[model samples]
Target: MIKPTPNPPELDDTTPYEFPGSKRFHEAAERALDHYLKPNALTLRFHKPSTMFQIAPDQDNESLLAHACESLASASIMTSDIAAYVDNPQRHTILAIQQIIMLAELAVNRVLDNVEMARSASHN
Candidate 1:
């Protein structure tokens, strides 16, 4: 009878599987993946209204209305910007939202025009 061959040594989970020089390659790849995949914290922050539109303690009705108009105008611009980046199919929805924003902006502009006219008439 022939002698039985010995089994090869078992590799434990604690053993390093990487070849030489591969560790640095893997680290560089991980850094590149992280750079591309990581989301920006600043972009995820909640947005607040601009300080320019903030109401002062002594703000008048006309000034408040003007600020509202400016805010609506800004909203329209933002909606358009959002629509610009959207892909097809979903882009249609963004465009619809942009249209609604524009409508609201137009309505606010009309109100602002009427307020200005009244203010001018009163002043005269």
Candidate 2:
């Protein structure tokens, strides 16, 4: 059984773009693609922070931790207060949230104590 159209001629797969100085051009194209596509760690590290809220770079750790402890304590109190005003299931939820806040406050208090101890030890 003979076919109407014959088989197509075999040709070399290499294109004009693949020869001569194209190796350098290919490398440059790849680098350009990677630059746009890949997330660079250096860029991530130096990315701009939110302008609306930021802590002072010069702030000491002790003061920061102390503020954190106070904030967590206040949050715990607020959640307990809210729990008193809500329904049974909501109250349970609020109480659970309050417990989490209380645990955070305790952890912050421990860190504050450690910071104070370290400072005192360094002074002596």
Q: Each model's TM-score, in the order given?
A: 0.49, 0.60
Per-residue lDDT value at 9 in model 1: 52
Model 1 per-residue lDDT tens digits across residues 2-27: 54754565566662436777777788
State the lDDT of candidate 2 residue by residue for 1-124, as single tens digits: 9867657755769775767799889889999999999879999899987878889999998899889988998999899899889999999999999999999989989998898898899999
Query: What do the candidate models score in CA lDDT, each in turn?
Result: 0.77, 0.89
TM-score of 2: 0.60
Candidate 1 has its poorest 10 consecutive residues by lDDT at: 9-18
lDDT of model 2 at position 113: 88
**Runs off by more than 4 Å, candidate 1:** 1-58
Q: Which window of 10 residues has the lowest lDDT sum in candidate 2?
A: 3-12
Each prediction's RMSD to truth: 13.2, 14.0
